[model samples]
Target: MSNRDYSMAFMDGGLGDKAKARYRKRRKALAKTVGMPYVIYGLDQGPGGGNPWDSHVPVIYQDPELLYLTGVNQLNTALLVDPITGADILFLAPHDAKKEFWEGKQLGVGTKAIEKLSKEITGFKDIRYIDDLNEAILEVLKASKKRSIGTFWHEATQGKKRVAQDSNYRFKKQLERLLAKERPSTKVVNIAPQAWDQRLVLDKEDIEDMREANHLTGYCFQDVLVAKKSLKTETDVAGYLNGQLQMRSPFGQSFPSIVAGGKNACVLHYTKNNDPLPKKGLLLLDFGLRWNHMHADISRTIPVSGIYSPLQRVLMDIVLKTQKAVQKATKPGATLDSLNTLAWDTLNGLLEKKVLAKGGLAKLEYETAPHRIGHLIGYQVHEGDPFRNYNDVALKPGMVISNEPGLYGYFELTINRHRYKEWIGIRIEDDLLITGRGCENLSIDIPKTPDEIELLMAALV
Candidate 1:
């Protein structure tokens, strides 16, 4: 018998049709808003090369955009929508007998059984194989009076020179070519921007995923605290934390765990978790979990010895205070740019007052933590660059943003006639869901106070 239940080749993460219908419906709304007849979303299931890496399971990464629109994830899934009539079609891959015993089955166009299953899963009236994608596009174009093409491709160019960002952008280029030969004087409107605008705010279904993952993210931090006493290296902490997270959720880390010890913490975006735990500094842990297609990012800077020294306590307080101030200023109308400015002002105030650092210790540069404090989080750890286009977008209810403020610097200061020299990096990151009155700190449960962390880690056997 063929693979029963038709589990996806991936971890089969999705809310099915009902929860994701809002995203699919956006295609129709987007087409109308952009004045296009048809909108096409063609997503490729990667590593499609035949018989390569056989038997070795390579996990599939679902693009945040694709997953947001269609909850179900599999190989080569596409959706074609005709805004004129508010009709949509879901394209999928058919079953293969060869891999039935191992990789299970996928949704596709076929017999009544297959069609019903696809319809029930995707909530689309029409279900077809991906092979029909080209023909479907041509027909949608030909049938409509509008001489135009609709697809999401944020084309990056240096004056007509094609400069794509990543593999996804490269693949979108292929879809552009499919529609380029359609006819003369065809209008190409990029629906991608509109889709991104729609994605900025989370719907009810999305918020649930975000909240669950966030709660578990804090739990994962507590799990590490219990084992941190025995974990002597950064790599060990990362491995153990990630292992415990996956044991609970279907998917694992949003990105490689950033486990930095002591001065290594100053190296932002540090992923080389091989340093030994230092006897006199902080350990920065930055990690997130993927739950139900939504991601939650959290960062905590804690003392390596389960107790913060006077100097370490000041540094930790600086970061925690900066984060608290930003969180307080997060309102529905405040923009990311404004929030980030508030973060820096708060940090600088603390340092300028000799609360933690001296004048020479704080500098706004790539190595420091002031430039980029947070990013928009969702299906991916980073949805977009906060300093770029995402900077000025006003925080409305349902919009989620990250509030992380810290200082990363190298300095030597004399305290009580004792000279201290090290690279100090402390960052506290939490997801803030913009609410009507204010914003909710989704990761607030994660222990960050020196007293709380000391108590938690001190419990370790």
Candidate 2:
């Protein structure tokens, strides 16, 4: 394992109190419509088969005392000024010492460490046995009265599914039965969609962590550009980028690394890294470094030979121009829909000009620009938010969005000959944080200019 202490690496930046206040106002307004806002988080079960404690899974199992403290502290902060009964709030966890020995050492619950970590201002009691859960749930349900009992439900589980031979869906059935019996009057809250949408907009601590990841991501891309000569294959570049990211404080990737070379670059969500780079073609790399679950997403296209060919330059210029326009309009008040529309218009205009100037094809129209110009990047690679149906959800400070503009043109095709097919495909992406005045380009060092990129790459051995 790398020596970098990711957890202790303090991020100097944060969302600030102003952003927190804004979130408070927004959340309060939301709470009025959906009652007081007390949420129960069921700790994730640890991974089996002898894998090191996946930090992604609940660490509450490894150190019950610490996790309990975290839960208690969070609950206290939530109920700070509320008029709700102290006993109504509860932190539920399965306390099994035998299971702890099977996994790892467990910090005993109700210790001084737990108290300090939890910021013990709020009242809470921990139940050791699963048998006590039934009575505890009943008490909470009775106390809730008019206020609905709130709990988050997992929307989906990805990566490997286990099935039982005799009882199909036995795990889910048993879970539902347990929950149903625990509290008959309890109401489950569908925060999955809400969490997904809000994820794009970082909170105080989230921004602090993400900014560090963003800084690292930018610096690492510079390394990629500098060492392009050594990077002959997609896998080679992916490994290089992953090494840079992992060598830093954080030890994992935000999402699967994309290092598509040549025509493979056209594949939007490309993850296959085995392809070899053509001598003088384009390479589109989309990746991110994850820090404390917070991530910074970035994508860049570069010339394989350190200098773009005429056709490569043409496609790159158009994509760059589209991105520039999108960046210009990416203010705090703008929405993704408006940004996407602007990107389309900008790209289409450039395509039209290129066509008319060269007399390539007057009939072709650059209508839709592949994907969205900007998206929320945070906790989850694609952060969660609540505003799904609303197309005009105004942007705000503390929101980090991606400005990815792509141009895909194929050669020797019958449909649209104007689109360059042979040696083309460019996507330049960067993570930007919306500030009070306008925005801050977090991934600033990764070069976009042809001259800057060429000069930087030439310096490397």
Candidate 3:
């Protein structure tokens, strides 16, 4: 762990007020729509025993909705909102002086400093210990004649078996069961969609934070690009970029750094940085830096040597052209489905012209480009909706998405008489912010063009 204290910066409370305001507005809207009296959101407690790896090194991940409502980053926290009265209550874990001696300072409830910090960071005046959580829920239920209670309950994407094994999910389910037993008449409803709708649009502060993350991530990427020649292995490059990010910010990489070389680039999300750089092949780096809970997803491919070969240049140009075309078509009101279609058409056009492949565009995309053109980026590396479904969701201002166009060819898969073989796996990813006029490339600072990448690498060599 980097010896940098991100606690202060993380608690600087950038979007706390705005997020609270938005939550208030959403509460009112939900009351009018569903007539729900109160909504409860639980934050994930720092990792516990179920997963051995997680238990060893607990990864603290706050629930996105709860984090939006209350800027509390600590573990074992919950948020309760009463739509009828516009009241917000935050529950905190009881402070243990002994635990603090071993661990760190825990945020104490009702303390003078805690009160001030809560008000500044969460915009909530009422802070109570975890012991009061049950009583507080009971009080809210009794006050509302309807006895209607709302809590987030969404099926785990990974499946019920996985959720059962998850400590956090199990904890949340226990809480839900407790609520059910406490008040049998309580009408429980899922508030996940309401929260998701609100989170879809990024506020001013959210956008600014994303921009800062993108800038910092771009800087680290530039360093890695320039140092490619000196980097002996993929892990070395990942370490260097990680160190650079830590030196500047208290947070770590948004996601696991992907430093794939040569054939490994064909596997999207290849996190095994143990691969060696080929004598002369492409190096695909897909990395991002997380700052202030915001993420910047970026990917760039460059030659292990200072210059791209003839075949590599041809494949890279196709991907770049597809990315440029998609970016040009991206704007407010543009549907992701249309943009994705444009990407497919642009890449397929090259294939038809015998520039990329002989055939098997669909098969190649299915195996390699399994992911969409891009996904919404923000608090999570992959946030909100993806680029699929026709005319489902239209792009709007304040929406940030990725514009990554890629092409991966395996050695077994013959593309142009297998001349290129596994030698080509190129993906050019850049964070894009949708605007009224057009989309702005947040990762533009990092070089993408063949000449630009070669020039930077040459300087370092």
Candidate 4:
């Protein structure tokens, strides 16, 4: 088990003050949308929530919306934004020095240095102990003429139908149940959808942050390629990438690294990096590293032995072509739903020519790689609202989204009058910037094509 100290990764990189200001404006905007005389409470997620405290302290992530809006990334804290007032409140636990000795320093109301920093950085009107939350909420509710309260309801993977299983959801339900028991007149509102839409348009600073993250992730990916020939197993590949990321980044991987070898790649979300390397097949790597709490997601499939087979090269071209088609389709005024449809149709069109069997597409999709086209990228890996939630929302400039479309399954077809059966997985993912005319692939410069991968590998090794 990792030491508790190493479990959490955080590096503000001096962007905290500016990010907080931008987020403050976002809260005010949400305030206007929900109207003044409203109270919105956002929670900091509890310690990774699972079985008990025997394991290392998990990453005590702040609710993405809470961190996005309030810039307070600490445990045991809750934010209450009073849109009607000049500044909202941040309630945290008072310091327990004995626990701090065991765990680590926490941002509490007791420590003078922490007190000053939290106030300066968060811009909250008041920072009180967590014990004051109920009284504070009561006061805000009484003053909230709208008779409503709000909180963000996304848990990063809310699209997976496990919405009720997360801390944020529990926070929402608790508020509802509490109000029903004592304050029946008040209504609980999910301000997440509106708050999420607000994040769709990234400011210049936010975009730059993402680009920097992509640039560093690209660097680490190159380093991974440099060591790829020596990587003898899937775990070796993942470990090498993790080491590279640690060398360059204070905060490491944004998501669990996927380093699947050969048929293991057929599993779209494959994360078991324990398999031995295949001498003659492809290795799929899908990983993202974080910078300043922003995430950069990129996936590339390369050969295990530093060169792609003839068949591997051909299938790769098809996936790349589908990706290019979808890239061209992404632009301002284009709906996400349409882009997704176009991607699948274009891919199926290309695949049908290669596979001559009834229901081939269904078999591949359902049995192998069944996933939505992409999603918005930001503070959290999955970020705000799922694609389906805002499927009809037109793509706009300043928005960053992913474009990942691929097919993975056993390929059984008649080629040259011979039976061809092999499990191949080819997925090329990139972070894209939605622009006025068309979108730009932020990770495009990272070598991906057969020629690009081969030449780079040869040069490095």
| Each model's backbone clash number | 0, 10, 0, 0
Per-residue C-alpha lDDT of model 1 across residues 1-461, encoded as one tens digit per residue = 12326434322244433443565565656666766654445445354444676543324465556666565567677777776655577777776656556666666666778778667666577778888887887787777666776666554557879665544455556656776765645666666667777777777777888898888888889989998877899888989988977776766666677999887887888999998989778999888887766788888998888888776776677778888888899988898888778788777787766544443344334533345767788766777532246778777898888888877876555567665666788888899999999999888787889999999888764
Q: 209-234, model 4: which lDDT tens digit per residue?
A: 78888899899889988988788999
**By lDDT, highest first, what's the ranking?**
4, 1, 3, 2
- Residue 203's lDDT within candidate 3 is 73
Q: lDDT per prediction? A: 0.72, 0.58, 0.70, 0.74
The RMSD (Cα, Å) of candidate 1 is 3.5
Q: Give the TM-score of candidate 4.
A: 0.88
| Model 2: how far residue 450 lies from native, Å | 1.8
lDDT of 3: 0.70
Q: Which stretches of candidate 2 lie over 4 Å from their true place?
A: 1-34, 46-83, 87-134, 153-201, 361-367, 385-391, 411-423
Runs in model 4 lying further than 4 Å from the true structure: 1-13, 36-49, 53-60, 111-114, 154-163, 354-369, 412-421
Per-residue lDDT tens digits for candidate 2, residues 242-341, read: 8887777433677778888877877788888888898888788888777654678888888888887666666678888888888888888898899989
By TM-score: ranked, best first: 1, 4, 3, 2
- Cα distance off (Å), candidate 3, residue 442: 1.3
- For every candidate, C-alpha RMSD to the true structure in Å: 3.5, 7.5, 4.5, 4.5
Error of 2 at 67 (Å): 10
Model 3, span 207-308: residue lDDT tens: 888889889888887888767767888888888977887676665677777888898887888888887788788988888877775788888998888788
Clash count (model 2, backbone only)? 10
